[model samples]
Target: MVDSGVSAAYPIIKNYIESLGRSLNDLENILLTHSHPDHIGCAAKLKEKSGCQIWAHSPERRMIEETDLQFSVRPVPGFHTLVGGSVSIDQELFNNQEIYLEENLMMRVMHTPGHSAGSVSFRLSKDDALFTGDAILLPGEMPIYEQVDEYLLSLRKIDEVGAKILLSAWDEPKSGAEIPSILRASKNYIEQIDSAINTTCQNGKSDNPIDFCKQVLERLKLPVPLANPLLVKTFQAHLD
Candidate 1:
């Protein structure tokens, strides 16, 4: 599987695999797009049960193994309990690295760090599909990043791929003509957020980040919880 959903999702994944006439043990590799808890939650357990080798970008290896790196938000209540435990990466992936799944199946790794320092996207050479984790979040969903430049660049990189299928972690897959628009929309959303932040600061609405984020959220018609700690961090990243 490209990215395991979460710890609670293991049974579903295993059952799906079995439905395909393959057992969990039949799986050999788990390619991670990032080290986020939701993305990597079931990796260790899957690896333990299936003896699958977990692969992730080198920068994300430490975070995946140690589970110490804080990407966007500080751990809130039940954070550890909800995110589950960490897993060790068996192999470290690099940009442009080609991973062979079979004689005819190969995937190219792209370092698309923006959402997190070690975030990555994968392009399936044979399928003409790009699996973008949180690198390109859907509209109505908050996009958090530690670096704005990196995130923007990553979006461009994804666009350059021109893949027929664009698969995102949080959003439904986009194919054909719809794919390009999704990429453009992701970039445009970030730019709009940046502009709003600048305008808010210039108008001297609220200097406090929390209040500033609220103002931006209201202006954009996004929910408070969505903007609070998540988009708030994105705002902070831009300010920094």
Candidate 2:
């Protein structure tokens, strides 16, 4: 990861990979799900060292190139400013497409946008393992998605995939009924936030955004930390 913060600059897994007698140059390709810094932070350096081909969705093409990066406070109504970074993707992937990496390794590309306009997920059909970018979040916590409707749709699509193992870049991997259950909880939380926003807005209480968000959590009997700015954005998207 690039130096966004203290922990952000360091590549935690780089040495470990190198120790396995796998040089950076040994990697065949780099698959990117989105342009978030935490995900794309070490990309440039890694690609430079390894010369691995980078593949990503078309919409995030400009972000990785470090061109026209925009940060907006009111990305949507009632939501806090979302800090975003830009990177240009070297290659573009499509929805419901399968890409063969090697004789036995094939990754199915699925465009499950929600965290961003061009978010994606990759699946190894044979292993039933899904790399769900940031579309599916951790338990008791919400991952920020710019589009609420798209996020819900993506969640449903995951069910259709019937992945046995759900792997997230930011959180622990999920198995058994964990992934499906977390998806359900995420949807439920979205609905709860929507309801809270409606009630708060109906009472003309949208002026105090922070208070409104806090109140919404209190009313829903949910943890404030769990229903953070990310969850708040989901609520804001519904209202929009």
Give me the candidate number with maximum lDDT: 1
TM-score, predicted candidate 2 vs. hidden true structure: 0.80
Candidate 1 lDDT (Cα, whole model)? 0.83
Candidate 1 error regions (>4 Å) = 68-73, 76-78, 225-227
lDDT, candidate 1, 1-240, per-residue tens: 898877888899999999999999899999999877788878888999999999999987877787656433355344475455778888999999999999999999999998988999999988799999899966656656778999989888888889999889987888998988988888888888888778877878786777888888877778765545666777889888
Give lDDT for model 2.
0.68
lDDT tens per residue, model 2, 1-240: 111211234354466667887766686577888766556656666666677677878887666565234224223222111213343456688987788877787788898987888888899867789988778755445436688788889999988888999887766888988877888987887776677768877877755556666767776676665545556665667777
Candidate 2: list runs displaced more than 4 Å: 1-10, 71-87, 208-233
lDDT of residue 14 for candidate 2: 67
The Cα local distance difference test for each model comes to: 0.83, 0.68
